[model samples]
Target: MWHDKSVAFRLVRKKDVQETGELEAQARVDRRTKNLTKRLQPGNIAVINHSDIDRVSAEALVECKPRAVLNAAKSTSGRYPNLGPGILETAGIPLIDDLGPEIMDIREGDILHIEDARVYRGDELIAEGTVQTEETIAASQEAARAGMSVQLKAFATNTMEYVEREQDLIFDGVGVPDVKTNFEGRHVLVVVRGYRYKEDLAALRPYIREYKPIMIGVDGGADAILEEGFQLDMIVGDMDSVSDKALTSGAEIIVHAYRDGRAPGRKRVQDLGVEHVVFPVTGTSEDVAMLLADDKGAQLIVAVGTHNTLIEFLDKGRSGMASTFLTRLAIGGKLIDAKGVSQLYRSRISNWQIFFLVVAGCVAIVAALAATATGHALFGLISTWFGDIVHWFATLF
Candidate 1:
C-alpha cells in the first residue's frame, strides 16, 4: 500500500545520504499545514509548525505530493497515537521532526537542500532534525496509545462542560437558526471533508438520486459537493477553509459562531451579499449542521466523512470533538453514516420489477424474431420440438 521509502527518504541512510549530494526543492512555508497544502504543488517541500499532526493534515500533505515535510514542532508528541507521522512515513514522504521555529523563516519558493535530514540554503545550513523512519513512527504511535486514556478522560470532561453550557441548544433546540432551504420531512446529506469523504460521497450517488437529499456541506465539504456536480442547498462552517466560489454559490449559509456571537464568517458571508444566518453555538461546525438538520425535522440525516471513533476524535486534536459525541447521542436515531446507508440501504428495485424486466426483454426478442421471414418456419419447428418433448415426458410419467 506504500511506495518505497528508500526512493526519496534515503536521507536516513548515512552512506547513501552522501551518495546523493543533497535533495533541493522549493519550500512552501506556513505555520498551518492545512493552509500551506492549498498552495502546495507536487515535489515542493512543506515547512509547517503543527504539533502531533493529525490524520487529515497528513493526508492533505500526501495528496499534495510534497517531496518532504519539515516540521517546526513535534510530529508525534506521544499523544493518543495520532495517525499523522505514520501516514507521512507510509506515503514515503520524509518527515523531519522539530527543526525549531527558525525553520519557518525559510521563505516560500526558497530552494533548500535536505542532506542527512539537515536543511541548508546554498552554503548555509539553516536547520537539522530527525529523519523519521517507519520504525520511529511505529514506536511513537505505540507509546502514544498509553495517552489515550488521558485523552479520553479529558474529552469526557470537555463533553460534560459543553453539554452543560449548551443544554438549551442540545436538548431543546432553542437557538438553531432557521434556514430558507427546507429540510422538513426530507433526508439531509451532511458532507464533511473527513476520512474517505470523496469516495464515500461518490458511493452515495444512487442514494442521492433516489432520496433527492437536501445536500449540506460543512466547510470545505461544499467544494466537494460542487466537484461532484451536485446542487448544494446549504453550507455550515466558519467560512475559513471554504472557497469564495462556494460562498457565492447561492447556497444558504449558516455560519457557526462562537458562544459570545463573534461570527467572523458572518462578515465574509455579508460581504458576498448572499443569504446567510449565524448560529452562535459552542460546538464544531459539523455538529451544528447535523443539529440544524435534526431541528428542522429532517426525516433522516446521512453523514459523509464524519469522525466517529475515539481515535478519529483524537486525530482531530480538538476538545470540540466532545460535542460530536454529544451531538450523536442527541440525534443518533435520525442519523446514519454514508458507509452504513451504502451497506444497508439497498437500491429500491423490487422483485416484481426484475420479473417484468425479464419478461419484457423476452417478449421484445420473440416479437422481433417473429416479425422476420424465417420466423414462421422457426415457430413451426419450435412447436414440433415442444410436442415431442411433452410426449417423452408423458411416457416417463
Candidate 2:
C-alpha cells in the first residue's frame, strides 16, 4: 500500500506585500533649510525645521528634486500667506507638516518609510505627523490671506519704530561708510536675490549693455551677475551665501557688519584674502546697497529683484525690512525698480535687426533701380555678363 501510494502535488505562492507597503526613501535632515538644501540630492527626503519657509528657499528645494519634505515646524504659520509650501506642493512633492522635534531623531542619510501620516524606520514606527495635501495647503493659504491685515498692521508698526530709531541716517547719511567705489553722476544697478530676479535681469540686458551702470550685487546676486557674463563692479552683502568664485571675480567687496561692530561674515572674507571694506550699520544688506549708492551721489539707482510688496517683505521674515521701507523713502525720486525702468526705456535696436534693416533697404534700392531706364540698361549688362560666365563654366565642364 505504501509503494502504490502516490504523493499529491500542491503549489503555494507568497503574496506581494512589499508592493503595497509604505514608501521607502533616504533622508537628509538639517535645522536650517539653506544648509540642508546644499546636501540634498534627488530622491532624498528633506527634513527641515523652517517656519514660514520663503519662496526663495522653496524654489531652492524644488530645484533639488527631493522625494518628499518633512517639516519639524510649520511651513506656513499663517504669516502673510508665504508661497513656499504651495510652491513645493504644486511641484508634486509630498510634505509632512509639524512632525515635532521627535522627527529630528531620524539621522541624516537614514532610510525612512512613510505611509499615510506615519514615518517609520524599518519595522519600528518613528513619528506621526500631518500630511499637507493641496486642500489643506489651500485652506492654510486662505487663512494666511485673511490674516494679512494683522501682518500689515504689525509691519507698519515696526516700520514706524525703525524710522524713529534710524531717522538721522535716512536724510543726512551721517553713519554711512565711505568706499573707494565711486557712483557719482552715474547710474547704479542694485541687484538682490528676490523674486523673478533672473527674468528682470534678462529684460535689462539692453539697458545693462547701453548705460553700463555701476553693477552692485547683494550677496548671491553677485553670482547671478557673474553667471550672466557681466563684470561685478562691487558686491555688497553680509557675505553669507555668496560663492568663492564670485568673491574672486575681481569685484570690489563690502562686508556688511552689525551695529554692535560684530561682522560675522568679515572673517570669511578675510580668510579668503580678498580685499574688502567694512560697512558697519543696521538694517539689511539691501538697505546698505541703496544707502551706499545714494550717498555716493548716484544719478539714478535702478533696483533689480528688490522686495517691493508686503508679502515680499514678509517672505524675507525679517522685521528689518523696516529699513528697506525707510530706505526707499530716503532715496525716493532717484530709486526706481528695474521693472519700471525696463518698461519705460526702449532697448536699442539689436545688431541683427540693424543688419536685416540694411538688407531690406538694399533690396528696396534694387527694386527702385529696376523700375528706371538706367536700371534696365544695368540689368541687361549684368545679364550679358552672367550669360558669358555660364557659357565659360559650361565649356569647362
Candidate 3:
C-alpha cells in the first residue's frame, strides 16, 4: 500500500551535517553563542550525524525549532549522555540516527519513507532500511563521551610541549616587558579574531567616537582595525598576519612565544623595521593579546572572531583547545566576547517577522506545487487566469 506522494528534495551528505553539528556543540561549550541557549522552536527538524550529536552542535537540536531530527550518523555502539539518540529524547525531538554512509549515496529527488526507511530513486527502489532504536542511541552517547576525552588528552600534550619551550625562553631573558600600562582614564579596546568581526566593526563606526577605546589589534586583527580606518595603538600576536600598513601604523608590537625562546613570527616584524617586544609563554596569540591588555592595565578587552571552542581549534588542526579555554578563564571579568555583545546590543530579526516569513514561504511552496498539471494544462490555466484578471481590471477602469 505504498502511495506515490514523494517530495522532490536535495540530499545533503551525512558527513557535512555532522561537521556542522559538532561546530554547534563546540560553540555552546565555549559560551560563544549563549544567548541562544535551550530555546528549541517547534516544527523545525534538523538532520545531524551521531558522531556530532554530543559535544558540538547538540545544543542546536536542543535549542532550535525542530519537530523531529534525523540522525545521519554512525550506529550507536559505545554510548554517552548527550551524544546518542537519548539526547533527542531528552529534548523531545525523536532520535533516528546511524542510518549509515549508504544514506550519503542517495540522489536528489529520491524518496525516503519514514515508516520503513526505504529509499526510492525516481521510479526505482534503491535500498530498504530501518530507523535506529533506543539501545543503539545509548551506545552512541558513550562513544561520544569517550571520543571527547581522547581529544582533550591530545590538547594537554600540545600545551605541555608549549610550556617546556616557554621555560627555556625565560632562562635566556627574552620575554615580554614588565612595563605597566597607563590606560588610567582612556578607553581601551583589545581586538581579537572572532566571529563576524568585519560586519560588527562596520556597524560600530558611529559608536567609535562615543567609547573612544584605544585600539589594540592582535596579529590579523590589525588588518581589521586598519580596514575600519582606525589607528592601532598596539599590535599584539606572533606577527604572522599583520599587514605592512598595520606594522607601520605607529602601534607598538608584541610577539607571542613559548619557553623554547623561538619567536617564529618576529622576523616579519624585523623585516618591516617595526619596534616590538617578546611576550614568551605557553599560549596562543589571542591569549597573549588578553594578557598584554590586563598586565598593561587596559580598561577593557573587546574580542572578536577568536577561537573560543574545541571544534574551532580542531578546525585549525590542533590536538587541544587549551589556549582558548584557559585564556577565557584568566581574563574572566574584564573580557567581553563581541559576538554576544553584538547580538545583544546590535540589531536582530524580529519574532513577528520570522513567523510571517515562515507562513508566507509555506503558502508559496504549496501554491507553486498545486499549479503543476502535466506542464501543458498548467500553462493553459495560467494564461486563461491572467487574461481574465486583466480583462476585469480593464472593465473596472
Best by lDDT: 1
Q: Rank the candidates by lDDT, best first.
A: 1, 2, 3
lDDT of 1 by residue, 227-246 (tens): 99999999999998899999
TM-score of each: 0.82, 0.79, 0.47
Q: What total of clashing residue pairs does each candidate reach? A: 0, 0, 31
Instruction: Select the stronger candidate by TM-score from 1 and 3.
Output: 1
Structure candidate 1, residue pairs in collision: none
Q: Local distance difference test, per candidate? A: 0.86, 0.84, 0.57
* Candidate 2: segments with Cα more than 4 A from true spot: 1-23, 339-397
Which candidate order results from sorting by TM-score in descending order? 1, 2, 3
Kindly give the stretch of ten consecutive residues in candidate 3 with the minimal lDDT sum: 20-29
Candidate 2 vs candidate 3: which has greater lDDT? 2
* Model 3 misplaced regions, further than 4 Å: 1-146, 156-175, 178-181, 345-397
Across 1-397, the per-residue lDDT of candidate 3 in tens digits comes to 1233434322222323311111110111111112222332444333434454433244445656454445445434442234424545555444455655554454322234332344444555544434444544555555566776766678778767654654343233345476434565555676665455666666666667788787878776788888888877888777766678888977887777654679997888888887778876766777676666665566677776677766467533344346666556666777777644555574478989899999999999768866776555776788899999999999998
